[model samples]
Target chain A: MWDGRLLRVDAREQAMINEEHRPEIGESFPVHAYYSDNQKVRIHSRIHYHSYYELVLVCHGNCDLMVHYELNAMVAGDMAVLPDKSIHSSFCPPGEDTQVLVVQFMPDFVYNGTLDTVDSRYMAAFFNSLRMKRHALFQTGEDLAMLQDLIWKLLREYQEKRMGYTVYLRAYIGMIIAYLIRRLFRNEEELINYLRDYHRIEEAVSFIEKNHREAITLAMAANQANLTYNYFSTIFHKITGHTFTEYLNLIRVREFERIMLGGGNSVSEAATAAGFDNISNFNRVYRNLRKSSPTQVIQGLRVAKS
Target chain B: MWDGRLLRVDAREQAMINEEHRPEIGESFPVHAYYSDNQKVRIHSRIHYHSYYELVLVCHGNCDLMVHYELNAMVAGDMAVLPDKSIHSSFCPPGEDTQVLVVQFMPDFVYNGTLDTVDSRYMAAFFNSLRMKRHALFQTGEDLAMLQDLIWKLLREYQEKRMGYTVYLRAYIGMIIAYLIRRLFRNEEELINYLRDYHRIEEAVSFIEKNHREAITLAMAANQANLTYNYFSTIFHKITGHTFTEYLNLIRVREFERIMLGGGNSVSEAATAAGFDNISNFNRVYRNLRKSSPTQVIQGLRVAKS
Candidate 1:
């Protein structure tokens, strides 16, 4: 997946660059910026990884961003930080008229010495944002505008070569990371907390999705994550902002609602099918979580359809 | 002077750049900037010219700035705007630790369209400031600090490559020019007024300097610049902010004071040497301009010597 002629570099030079630093960036100037307007961006040959952080911002139109095994639809103003060694490609259909601005630079460009310093939060956040992005879609319109503005500023600084330009460029990159930290990961403490449980949380979420049709317990969920019961309960609240039982019930209720909306199943029938064997327990959990009883939700969906 | 390899480009490339656009700039990027800290910048091989305007601002230490036939000693915070085709070089003494920020770009980078419009005044004022600098040292400490701040901002914006960096750069360049115009040329109407007669005033001032020891008259000064009496008078007032006779007297009084300060001569003889043949007229002009009679100036010098 990493090997391809579409990325464009002399073979020996590419090898030297790979050994020395990264592709699309060199030791002379450890930053590379490009503004591309492509109607159709091919992905098969373009799937590759790099040693630098790649900021790909869609200026206009829609594209599908492929990161590892994930394919997510991305539209105008959507962006993603493809971290070092993350295989990613952006594909678009013909006549999509997608415009994307890509800026890739070495991590050390934003890192001023040690990451322990207070001034290094932006650099820390840069790494954290890339790692913590469960949803790569940058949701807020204003936040997207601000990020695009930062990219534009970076491009001008890179191209103009103004006085103290390197300083300006690095500083702006730092600001971009700070902006992402605010918009993406929330805050430093939360980001650190998220990073700690990222893998564990993913395991828990996937396990619940696959086993929703069968009986599931907190101990079973903890065993799936290879964690002890008490440890799993404590960490689940810290990571997902919900306890194992509550999260599991919320998932079951959501599935039950979807089944009821799909057609003629009674609330109790759908609730049992979604692994909620106790009808009274399901009704109580659904009313508490959804602020409405299962019957009311089904009636509301029917009213909308009618 | 134009024949030198120090300029660092092949002849064909130079011509093509001079024709195609400007170096350190392309059609895509119209502005370029650089911050330099060089202690010993040699001038012997550094004399060159370009198609774009270059603004060199000294951040620290001192250097000898050569712009055309004028050689001025520039100290820290001093700056010079080298307009297109201006023969210029900066020579520094070794180990002085001089730092400077340079911003260079095609003129059209500032020119948004019609030169005659008010929107283009900043560009015009920018070019005019380069020409109207009778004191290119930038003078006031406050003004120097302001310009330095602007340079720093430009350097930061240039390096950061933020979104709308081009817009920010172009706007900042316009602002730098605006600041200079206000501080250097005083006001807009006055700036426009100065620019109109800038060349003619320069010619008149030089004519008076060379012919000050002779009998100088308003008509002679006007004819030297190939202008009529009334027209020259009007232009002289607009350009120098002084009437032609008042300016000529001001110059004569200055030269007369210089001669008297040298000593060993009577006030009358010194005044005659400065081309004030009528001693009574010299006394009146000196009293009006210096607020002291020639005899009193000589007496003050003698008292200081004693």
Candidate 2:
């Protein structure tokens, strides 16, 4: 019953991607349409991960986010990408309302040949690497802006219907992934910088996973790594692209998924076991992070596993 | 693209659903799954509501299907209760094929809930309706056997769950919609009464949609319906409960969404002009049936008038 229990529970638990959530999966012709559902909550989800990749763009206002465990004060123009199975969560923070353009997709959206058959050696190399494949966090303002534009363009093409937009979408997905790899792994220093503290960060993550039921904090994680608070916070973000709080929450979401699948099929059972003291917060956070509600997730899990 | 192009696109498209292609409006979920190279096809869709409601039970299938468009289909025993607009889609269909337990919920799934939250009223109404809902077409001996077993226990607790039963599964779904409804709606006139002249069925459906697209089908539909030799040979199965192909695709898949704050967008211009060949299908079917495939429908069309 962690906050993302509604959305993440089903998606995370089943590991199905967005394509499966669409009506046009195998249809030959594409259609564009508008959607407005005032009855539907605008934000639903919790910090979680599925096997498919995720990209989120904030179209309006600012948000306080934890991406791949990094705590970030994100603005309208900011964006982030979480790779397959990487734990991540995001929200507008307390009392702060924001509009987010959520983009959930599978790696096939890029890797599919509908994009460009021309495989860039750089992209091939980047995808081939374990570290680069693990996760991605975009900090560059320009890249974010460009990504936003490309997304807009893709949406426009999808809506407008050009000659070969499907191919374009595949290419755009690839371009975005390629761009992320280029930004993250542009130099040896970047890779080295990310790896040096990765061991400690991972250790911190495992510790959180192993002991999330108890009270834990940045200091605790820092002490486990034998580092100072300020240094550890910076190093944690640098290495894992998330802060300790974000990481802890991701771990909790992961645990929530585990419990939901194994036992604790009910809301109360799953939430408490996931470590959320207040079910409402669990609901709200789950909605914001996973883009679905807990009732939905539990229901989804039951249906999926059934 | 084939005439069924409109049915093919997904969330990545930009054009409005109404304008793209309207040939495939009322196609139900659980379409045949096939692989192209390595990419798997997945379809997410809402609950089925043709002229009537339906219920389906999936028994021994190792497939992955999304229930009501949110839950996952992980194994054999899952069941689901899908309200209209609640989505569903094909999951990993079992490898060597599998058995299914399907039920169609009638108008009763809703009315039963309303007549009073009174459990007895719902039960009585559900049981009474089951006779009419039970299909005699499940001619296979094994299907009849499984259907009988499902009918007994499933009816006892269609509204409530047994201990440790997963609520959001297809089996559960079949229980509520198929078996319970069958037991309730059972009527003498319902079994083995009608045999149609199958020689002209497709032509009949085509004539109905093209001429009476503006009007709803009545007893007139069954009176003159016929099927060609080839169609009569296989068409009945397609129109059977598990799958229902329409005379005209009734809805447009909303592949993309856009929010317009200002004027200057054209709905009709966005529709037929966008790329759809059958403008009338886009207009009548999209608005009345699919509700939102046209670009203008998606943009809210106020911009178009402006």
Candidate 3:
């Protein structure tokens, strides 16, 4: 009689041995899809975020993607953009063979700009294009072709990979994003406004990403946004759903988790590298938010894998 | 008084504008680089390809990086990956306060499937403790720290970028490949095999990325290795070179060129998807022997950026 769950008993401690699950670091290796019998299966998996952004191409099937509780049904040829820190998950309809190519990254992937000022308009257009309630993921016929080419190129690379495939893979990624923007925003007024707003938010986001290392104050972030502290603070919470400080810390935690999961450094190193000036403070926050200590989490993952 | 080739034009037609450089059907982005300076002072600017792969990271400095090699080079840590066949031209190097991150990817970037077959020994050791031949390329410890973190996280996500970050910037192209293999390979014997034979030669390379398209010629490739047309051509190649047919495409053209300068359905698709079917007859053999074209060379790359 075998059920999915398995438990080990520890006699000495007289307790059931707890299992540790080191969630796969999505930021480290985010693309996860299984294709069987012509169907692609991807578990809902854990929710997460990163310094870089993400773009998803739904090649086939139907599913509901829960981005902060806004459930949207996704089908073939649809694409979506998940901005930084937007909690999200995706689930395919029963028996639906879903195949999705997910591209996730951060500002560094494009340019190494601080969060205060990232002027890559191509990226802005990409983020803005997703703002549309419903739009063709590939606007131009050429764009669709380019996207298909990229997927095939990726598959081929993954299949028969040569040296430096990564270099070209990144280039394909850039081409897809550039094509998406060009196809959707051709000298339109909405495009202009989209760029403007995107820049504003981008500047704010950059501020958070770069300054998250130091003791970034609300006033500093507000100033970067060119708004009064009160106005910016209230609006920031609304848009990002966390106070500026909270948002900054969350960003750090996400990054910290990414590095730590690779099992390269000690917990303290992860904390320090992720921009925690105070270990005690970091630990307290980690416990409060994650409901566990960093060590416990790491140890738990190792045990589970064993 | 310092006229050291400030700008170089590699465009096939001097009059051909930037927008006109769009790729033909199935081609990936062209490869080129540029150089420039601010205030019309004086500076040297250049961009080109070397080795098998290329890497760019912003260490320090500021300039705008136009969509098409147009005007500026943004701040430090703004990185880009250029495969062979890509054409990128830069404006100028950053000011005195600039820091840059640049690494040229060798053909190994995608060829060996070192990252794919984790059971191999060399791959295991490399991943367990990743190191570059030149430490200077690593820059400051901080830079290495950030770069490595960025690299591995980027590799982890190469299979899936749900957001658009990987699309445009194509950053983290290097680290993802490195980490993928490092995390998976466990057997010592497999690791040794990877280091010794995986990196060099054609057949070994080919077997690594073997399965690209159904059109590939199994018989011809088998003969190329001097094996009976059907005596486990793939398995024989692996015994000698540690490879397979699914692996051969990586060494030849299917995986290598497909993503490099836009291998889409264009020349590479024909080469990898079609060329493998007739190894002796295809241009890959000629190119392998002569170091020249199965496809048109990325046209218009001048030795100097004007």
> lDDT by residue for model 3 over B1-306, one digit each (tens)?
112222222223232223223132111321222222243443333333222344555544654333222334455545444433333344544345544433333334223443343212333344322321111112233444556455444434343433333332233443344433433334445555545433332462254344345554656556555556545454445434323543444344433343333424455345545336664555645355324554433322222212
The prediction achieving the highest lDDT against the true structure is 1
DockQ of each: 0.01, 0.01, 0.07
Best by DockQ: 3
Off by over 4 Å in 2: A1-20, A24-41, A46-51, A64-72, A86-99, A112-121, A124-136, A142-145, A188-306, B1-306
- Predicted candidate 2 versus true structure: per-residue lDDT over B180-285, tens digit per residue: 3333224323311111322234445555444432343433544445334454435434332221223323212221122221232555444443333566755665
Query: Candidate 1 residues A1-306, lDDT tens each?
Result: 222111211122222122333453754566877677775553222445567777778788767776643666878877877766565565776666888887887766555345243333344544644643422456547677877777887798678754334544555665566556556555556656655665676788679878977888888889999988898888878666568787788667667756765674777788898889888888788767656556666675455334
Between candidates 2 and 3, the one scoring higher on TM-score is: 3
- The prediction achieving the highest TM-score against the true structure is 1
lDDT of each: 0.63, 0.44, 0.46
Question: Which scores greater on TM-score, model 1 or model 2?
Answer: 1
Off-target runs (Cα >4 Å) in candidate 1 are A1-28, A40-45, A112-115, A132-135, A187-228, A233-306, B1-306
Candidate 2 CAPRI grade = incorrect
lDDT of 1 at B288: 73
For model 3, residues A1-306, the per-residue Cα lDDT tens digits are 111111111122111222212243233432221222125444354333333455667666655565532556776667666654444555664566777766554434433233222224446555544532222333233354557556676556544544433444444555555556556566446556655654565678778877776777888877888988887777666445567777777777756765665564777888888888878999998777556677676565445444
- Docking level for model 3: incorrect
